[model samples]
Target: MTQTAPVMRDPGEDGRFGDFGGRFVPEALIPACEELHDAFRDAWTDDAFREEFHHVLREFGGRPTPITYLARLSESLGVRVYAKREDLAHTGSHKINNVVGQTLLTRRMGKTRVIAETGAGQHGVATATAAARLGLDCTVYMGELDTQRQALNVFRMELLGAKVVPVTSGSRTLKDAVNEAMREWVTCVDDTHYCLGSVMGPHPFPWMVREFQSIIGHEASRQMAELGVGTPDVVVACVGGGSNAAGIFAGFADSTAELVGVEAAGGAAISGGQPGVLHGMKSMLLQSESGQIEEAESISAGLDYPGIGPEHAHLAAIGRARYVGMADEPVIEALQLLSSSEGIIPALESAHAVAWIAREAGREIPSGSTVLLNLSGRGDKDVAQVRDILKGRS
Candidate 1:
């Protein structure tokens, strides 16, 4: 495969990446979105705000997560593989990175309360943790199915003093939870800032969330250099709303490394989707001929969404990154392989990347090349579901 450096561009002043992203929300929320955009732009340029945000990350959310070399797994695959250990972050996931940054942004906007939508519940837990620390009211909307599947996370959010509202609309999944959260934001925009969990949604959010989570890629690149390794041959991360993938991609967007985003086979929006609008952004979405969003199914709740971040759509369009899909069986197998071989248990969402490596090794990806995988979160929250899957398989 030819490796060429990609030119990375932030969204235009109108918050568009080519033809993918824009503010396609109700007029009532336009002013709120604009206010957030201005506030974030100003704060992002302020050194004090940057320092404070970095300070909070280091002191609270555990910044500078390590990159593990995964010797045995690499040996098994006949390739050098490194895992960016976002699982070691304080909240056991990369979700906390964006949450902490946005929590600070919420405070800067003088918002007294923050609301969010969650799928696997990691985002809700992170948002709740930040809100509790900052003394802000927090409410998390989660699909009823997700709340049940990730019950412990619901308890964790409540323990952090946040209300967890089970959303019973649509498919009872992430997209539905997002729908409810957007509605809640419309009614409570005055004092309640919607802390969107992923790098989706309207205008500034995709840009702002990427800026916050980009730390993962930045740190991974530095850590790899410290270990005497050059830039990776490829950087891989799973994409649902694409926050983690976008985060890691930001660091290497201008590099020669091939950026690969793995998606759930059952919900592979970019791989099997058409251009359409959903969640306030025009992105690649799994929709029917009539433009109705299709229900996405994936064993990983975090990847069970019909739409992807608009930036991902732009990248794919411009040939800056490659997107692929992995089914549940391989994801589960990859999860177990990492746990058994490297003694690292990865979140199912993260496992999709591993599954891709396994599927492509020595074929699509040549052996001995270096691969950097974003281990987005731990698998503790998925242990029960995986156990059931394993049981049924046996």
Candidate 2:
């Protein structure tokens, strides 16, 4: 499902993505980030590092997930809907792509522990799985609210030998969990690797995570070509921290394809958000005018983030990608539609993109237009919440 492409390597000097992706972290972590920067830069180009990355990706992490043509869904919607099935990846989401890469790099850096923050626990479980496979110590920080909502993922992480810590501060969700993870990384800088789940974060992280995840777009583009769909008319993905969107969009940045990023309307950073610093990067954030971070709410816990990845901010500013916001109701509708029509249950986070595509098909998308959507994760994590919503509706 994938093939090699000409890689675009950016130096990421001082980690600034057009004034959006700078390292605005505490002074205590500067040296750690610098060490990670140098280590990552060296290892990424090393032959041994490449070999190890490739080995784990193919042998253990399950690379080249399928590009499924959702014919029934397409017929119902009156457009060509193709899905790059990240949901079928190991650990049930696109998150494992970055985790496997980072876990290998962590081993190279002589780090013995891995740490991260999770909103819906997909990232947390992915990290935990990598840590368990590599025999490294793992710990994940999650908001108490999310811990309760996604308790099954907590149990999954525990099964994979990771200890989950609940963050109770602020809104008690992804943001607070990230705050706690950063604090942990600063304190345990020598022995720990912070496995960031998205493309948002200080300089090297945005650049590094994107490089790991760009595999999705790389293979997907090749698969599309093989399918005789030379160039898609549009590419759509839902954005929480923008990792999946960045991965898929990075592949078509130079193509004549139009890229669209979907955000949760309740937590719509692109539409009703401002540029500010949150969690060490300057990007579009839901913040107060006086510069305080605001809490975001969404039916989809994974997309309930206040700030987006810095690379996305740059892409938006440069006109490389258009950002769309879909409200909660539409997201639910899309989730139901895809589940019923295609029998493919998408994560609520990804349903935002489906909702956007549904709306676009109703108006803008011409009949028979080819649209590629990143089915970022499976909806197993969302069954309970979805059931609750449906029952309430009944």
Which residue pairs overlap in candidate 2's backbone? 2-219
Off by over 4 Å in 2: 1-11
What number of clashing residue pairs does each candidate have, in the order they appear?
0, 1
**TM values, all candidates:** 0.98, 0.96
Candidate 1: pairs in clash:
none
lDDT of each: 0.91, 0.89
Give me the overall lDDT of model 1.
0.91
Worst 10 residues of 2 by lDDT: 1-10
User: In model 2, what is the error at residue 164, expressed in angstroms?
Assistant: 0.7
- Which candidate leads in TM-score? 1
lDDT of 2 by residue, 113-143 (tens): 9999999999999999999999999999999
lDDT, model 1, position 217: 91
The sequence of per-residue lDDT tens digits that candidate 1 reaches over residues 182-270 is 99999999999999988889999899999999999989989889999969999999999999999999988888799999999989999
